[model samples]
Target: MPLTFTPHPFHPADMPPVTLITDETDDVELARAAHRSANPARGRIAVDPTPATLTSAFLARDILAALGRTAYAPTRAPVITAAPAWRAVACWFIVDGIRELTVLRAHLLTPERAEQLSVLRELTGIRLILLAAPSSATQAARLGTCLAETGLTDGLLRLTADDARAFFTRSLPTTTPLCPTFPLSAAPVSSQPGAARSQYRAGQLAACTWLARHRRATGQVPAQRDLELFLSRLTCLSPDPATTLARIRGAQGGFTAEGLRLSVPHALATAQGPGLSTLPFTARTAHHISRAVPGPPQLAALASLLFTGAHLDRLVQARVDDIDPDGRFLALPQPESAEFDHHNPPPPAWYAVPPSARPFLRAARMFRQLEQVPGHFHLFSKSFGYRLEALVKDAGHLIPALSHLHPGPAWHHQARLTHR
Candidate 1:
C-alpha cells in the first residue's frame, strides 16, 4: 500500500486550509504579484516546510515566485528550500534568491556548477548571491559578476591584515606567534682514489676462515648446520645462535661436495705447497703476490709461515714484541686450547727467520706502527681471520708452475725442520 499523510483531527476550525499546489499551468508569478501589491502584510506565503516533497520543477518555481513577491514588498522573508541535485529549479531558485540563500556543504559545489549558476543568472535576470564557502576560481568568477556590480557582500567579508592582528592581540595575550622554519642541507661526501672493493663484512670473515681451516684439516667441508655447530664451540662468538648461523651462511659462496659446503672465492685457500719439488716463481708472479697480499693481517700471516714456519694459531696469538730485532726470530706462543695438543707443537720459542721473510716482517712492523696496534700482548685480534684469507689469495695468484709453492701449514712445518 502507498503511504499517505493523514491529518490527525478532521475539524474545520481546528486546522488551516492546506492548499495542494498541483496545477503547474497556474500563473503562480501573477498570483504572487497580485497578492504582494494588494496587501503584503495580510497574506502569508506558506512554504512547504518539507523539502523532500518539493522535488518537481513546477513546485520549486512556485515556491521561488512566492518568496520573490514576499521579499520585494514591505514584509519579513519566509524560509524556502531547494535540493542541490535538481539542477534547473535549484539554479533558478538560487540565482533568484542568491542574496538570501544559506547552504550546507557548499564547498562541495563543482566548477561546472558555478559556471552553470553564472549562465543561469544571465538568462533569468536573477541576481546571484555567494557565501564564503565556495571560494575557488570558478566560484569566485561567478560571484564576481553579481557582487562587483550589485555591491553585495558574499555573506561575510575577510578581515584586513591590521584588523586581524589587532583582533588576535586583543583575544590572546600570551599565545606564541607562529614562525616558518626551513631544514638545513645534508653534508657532502668525501672522494676515494682507488677502485672500490666488494665489502666483505667483518662478521662474515671469521666464519669463512674457520670453514676454510675445517676443509683443510678434514679434506671435506661441513654442512651448513654442522658449520654452525662448530662455530658455537668457539668462545666469544655471537651470543645469538641464529645470528651466528646466519653469518656462516652468508660467508659461504654456494659450493657443496658430498652434502658438505665450502665457501670458495674466499681470500684464503688451503692448497698444499710442493715440498722438495719446489720451483722458482717468476718475478711477475712474485709482484702479483706482493700486490695481492692485503694489509698487515695477511702480511703477518704470510710472514709467520715464510719466516719461522709458525702454525696459524701461534701466528695469530704471537705478540709484536715477540720478534727479536738482532737475532731475526719470531717467538711462537703456546696453543690457546690444548685440543690441538696431540698435533705437533710450534718449532720453538725463538724460531729463526729466513732472509726472504725479512722484508715482509719489516712491512708488518711498519703496518703495526701505522695502525698504532696497541698492547704488546697479542699480534692479531680475533678479527685476524679477516686477513688470513687474503694471504691464501695472494699465493693463488702465482703463475701455474709456481702455483704449487702456495704456503700450507705442512709446507711451513717442513721448511722449519729444514732450516733447523
Candidate 2:
C-alpha cells in the first residue's frame, strides 16, 4: 500500500477572518495615545505603566468582547468587559462566589507560560461545566453565580453549553486525505533462540532491500547522511553486524528499510540513542512507520494520547507519586499550580476517564508501549493514572465500578480510601 499522511484539519489558515474593533465616534485617539505612552520603548528602553496602560487594557477588553460575540456562540464565548481598574475586583467576585479559584504556580511568569495558563483556564471552565453538571448541580450553580458576580453579565464574551455543542458539530474540510487501504497485518517476529537471530537478520536485510527498491521506484536516491543514520540504528539494535545487515537485505516491502531510514534521517539518528538502541522503535519514529502498516500498536498509542488531551511531555515525565491510588485517577490542579500553595497543598483528587474513550483503545495502548520500555514504566503508570483523572474530571456521569480499578499505593495508604 502507498503511504498516506493526514495533517490536522484545524490550521491557522482555516480560522475565520479577523474583525476589527475600531470606532471613529469612540475614544480611539485617547486609547492610542494612552497605549503609546504606556509602552514607549524601542529595543532596550524601559516602558512605564500609566493611565495609558489602563486605557489599553480597556481597549483590549472591548475588542475581546466584540470578537466573542462575532466569533463564538452565546454559550461558548467568554464574558469580556472593559474594566480598566476592575480586573482584580472581578477576579475577587468570581472567587467569592465560587468559594475558590485555582491558581497555577511556576518559577517564572514567561509570556508563553501566561498564554498557556489562559488557554488552560478556558478549557478547564468548559470541562468543569460538562463534567460537573446533573450530579453536581450545586457546583454548576456556584459557577454561574461566580460568573455573574464577576461582571460577566454582558454575555457577549461568555459561551453557553449550546454554543459549545454547535462549535464541535460544525463541519469543515478535511486537511489530510484518508488512506484508501491500510496494511493491517504483517508476520510476527520469530522467537526461536537460534532462529531469532536469523529472523532478525532477515527482517533487517528485507528492510534494506525494500529501501533500495523504493528509492529506485520513487527515483529519489537515498542520501548518504540518511544511510549512515539507518546503519547506526541497525547497529545499535543488533550488536551482531551480520544479523543486522541480513535483516536489512531480506525484507520485502514497498518502502525498503534503507529508504525508510533515509526518509526520516534525523529521526533515525535520534532513535539510535543509547536509551533507545535496544528498542524496536521510538515513539516519534513510528508515525510514518505505522502508515505503511495500519493497526500497529504504535499507531493506537499515538491516537489515544492525541484524542485524550494528554500532554506528551507531562506523560513522559510523570512519576508514580502523582497518582491518587484510592481514586485510581490522575489529579490535575485547576486555575492550576500557580493558584495553589505547595507548603499547605490543597487536597489533590483523582480524575477518572469515561468509558466513551474505549473507542480509542489504540491510543490507550501507547501507555502500554511506554510501560514496555525499560525505565519508563513509572512514567507510563503515572500517565495512565492521569488519564483516569482526566476522565473523572470530564465525565458527565460517575461510574462507581471504575473507582477501584486503580489500586496504587496512594489508595492503600489513604484511610478514607473506600468512602464513596
Candidate 2, 1-420: lDDT as tens digits: 011111112232332221112122233342233222221011011111222332334322322222111211222213233321122112212211221121211111223322332322232221111101222455445544543443222232333334423432331222323323345543333333575566555565645564667567776654433333333334333333234334433332223423332122223222222112222222322333222211212222333233222333333443333433221233322122555675655443222322222222322232233223332243233224344443223222222223222222121112120101
For model 1, where is the 10-residue window of minimal lDDT?
1-10
lDDT of 2 at 144: 43
Q: Please give the clash total of every predicted structure, in order.
A: 2, 52
TM-score of each model, in listed order? 0.25, 0.24
Per-residue lDDT of model 1, residues 373-420, tens digit only: 553756443324654453455445422212334433322222110000
- Stretches of candidate 2 off by over 4 Å are 1-118, 121-142, 148-197, 217-220, 228-277, 280-420
Which candidate leads in lDDT?
A: 1
Candidate lDDT scores, in order, read: 0.35, 0.29
Candidate number of the best TM-score: 1
